[model samples]
Target: MGDRVYLNVLASRFRAQLSYRTSFVLDFVAQMLGQGGELVAILVLFGRTEELGGFAAHEVLIMYGIAGVAFGIADLVIGQLDDLPRLIRTGQLDVMLLRPLSPLAQIATGDIQLRRVGRVATGLAVLVTVLSTSDIAWSFPKLLLAFTAPLVGAVIFGSVWVVACSVCFWIVDGRELANTVTYGSNMFTSYPITVYPSWLRRLLAFVIPGAFVAYYPALALLDRPDPLGAPAFLGWCAPLAALAAAGVAGLVWRFAIRHYQGTGS
Candidate 1:
């Protein structure tokens, strides 16, 4: 019953977005253009140099593709959670708690934005373009990693979103700080982590685990060694990283919800 309710709410939200055809089209195009600009920037950088942090242009594109697709999916699904502060300030969350459905599910499915699919499509196009032209030594495991990497990356990013957004329950105005983790991490992971200084690299890799989102998986897919001297098998540990992040997000979310004190409006 809960699953059915969630799906119905999601479907209705999706349909509502499509109802505004002109606005939807414009937003969709804007999303694609915004994402395309990032891709173009990567191309321009590579034009000036053959390699970035020891990664060739096409190799970095693999990272961009995977990170782009993953972040797009995460944004489309739960980006609405960023609005929690507004909802809290308005006391609308009181209404949500009165409902039988899970509050997290309600918030996530409440305002589904179909236009974000444009970003996902853009990323997928890059992924396909590079996958076709790159000289990857494809095998069964490699093929599986290529197929699963984006999904795993999505989980990692989504978990980061949830854990970060949970801060609204405390600060009520921490979305900017949260974005430094959610959106900031997306930009950080889109390129080779090798380019970053050692301290920043370690922070992204160990502290935030953004490197597991796409960087490590790209290495696994490309059959390249980690430039940082980590084992090759660490590339395949993305699932573990996703699971760990999800666990932390779950705990943080539950704790925040328990401590939530309405605005008393």
Candidate 2:
């Protein structure tokens, strides 16, 4: 019953947004630029060499292409969904909490940036092109994992956003730190992780949960022998890692909220 009400609210808001054509065009162009930069980086790197970290130019192309699209899809659908912390700090959260619907549900469907759809379309085109040319041996399990990879990436990335927002409860201005983690992680994950130094790779593994986002699944899809020797089954850990990250974010959010209420920040 509650979900329906929130859905109605979101649907109404989405329609209202569509009524503004100028806002939509500007947003779409901006999303294109962001995704375009990512593609351009990969192209420039491949132009200098045939492969990086044992990944062929084509393979890395596929990786970035798919990763870009997957990331865009998540962003288009729920990208701005991470702004809850700013909303809370600005007292916008109070309005949300007072509603009959669950705050999370309300936030999830609160806004849809239709302009980002261009990124989504361009990304899908690249992913399909790479997959068609590549010699990846497709199977049911592999295909399932391919489809699931982007979703896992979104959840993992989104959790970082939530964790950042949660901190606003205590330090209303702590969002800068969150942006560092979220944006830094996004830029790093756009490439093959193996290309990085050992220390950096390890940092991503423990601190950011990025290894599971692209590296592990790419290993499975590409059928590349794991140079790190991670177990073959480790490739499937993306969803689990995403869930764990979200759980931790949930805890942090609760803690932050408590501090917010107590400190009145």
Candidate 3:
């Protein structure tokens, strides 16, 4: 019942966006171009250097593809949480609290932007192109990891989105700060973490676990050892990282909601 309501609301919003066909097309193209520009930058860098952070061009593309797809899915789904400040400021959150459905669920499903599928498409194209052209050792486990990595990465990113946006309950204007975590994580994971210095790499890898989003998975798929000297098995730990992130996100969201007082607007 609750799931059905969420799905229905998402479907309605998706259809509403599609109603503006021209606007939707332009939005979709703009999203693709915006993300595609990053890919172009990666290619241009490779033109000048044989390797980036000791990674070949194709290897970095794998990271980009995974990060792009994962972030696109996260942005398409939970990205609306960025609007929490507006909801709080306008007292809309108070009305949400009176509803039977979970406020978080309502906020997540309130808007479904189908145009963001453009980013997913862009990533998928790159993933398919690279996988077909690159000389990866194909095996059952590698194939399974390839398919599952993006989904797991999406979960990790979504949890970060929730946890970061929950700060709105207190600050009510913390969207920019939250973007540093959410969008910044996406940019960080889209490249080999080796490109970053040791301190920043450690922060992304352990503190935020952004490396699990794409870097480790790409290494796993490539059957390469971690140059940072981490254990080989760390590549398979994205699911565990995602679970931990989700747990923290849930706790923080619940704590925030429990302590929330209306803005008195």
143-180, model 1: which lDDT tens digit per residue?
98998898899999999999999998988899998888
For each candidate, the alpha-carbon lDDT, in order, equals: 0.91, 0.74, 0.91
- Model 2 Cα lDDT, one tens digit per residue, 166-243: 665666676677677766776777777878998998887657787777778878888887776778777888889998
Residue pairs of candidate 2 with colliding backbone atoms: none
Clashes of each: 0, 0, 0
Candidate 2 global Cα RMSD? 2.4
Per-residue alpha-carbon lDDT of candidate 3 for residues 46-97, written as tens digits (9 for 90 to 100): 9999999999999999999999999999999898898999999999999999
Off by over 4 Å in 1: none
Considering lDDT, which of the candidate structures 2 and 3 is the better prediction for this target?
3
Q: Please give the distance, in angstroms, between residue 111's alpha carbon in candidate 3 and its true position after superposition.
A: 1.7
Error of 3 at 95 (Å): 0.6
In order of appearance, the predictions have TM-scores of: 0.97, 0.88, 0.98
- Model 1 gets an lDDT of 0.91
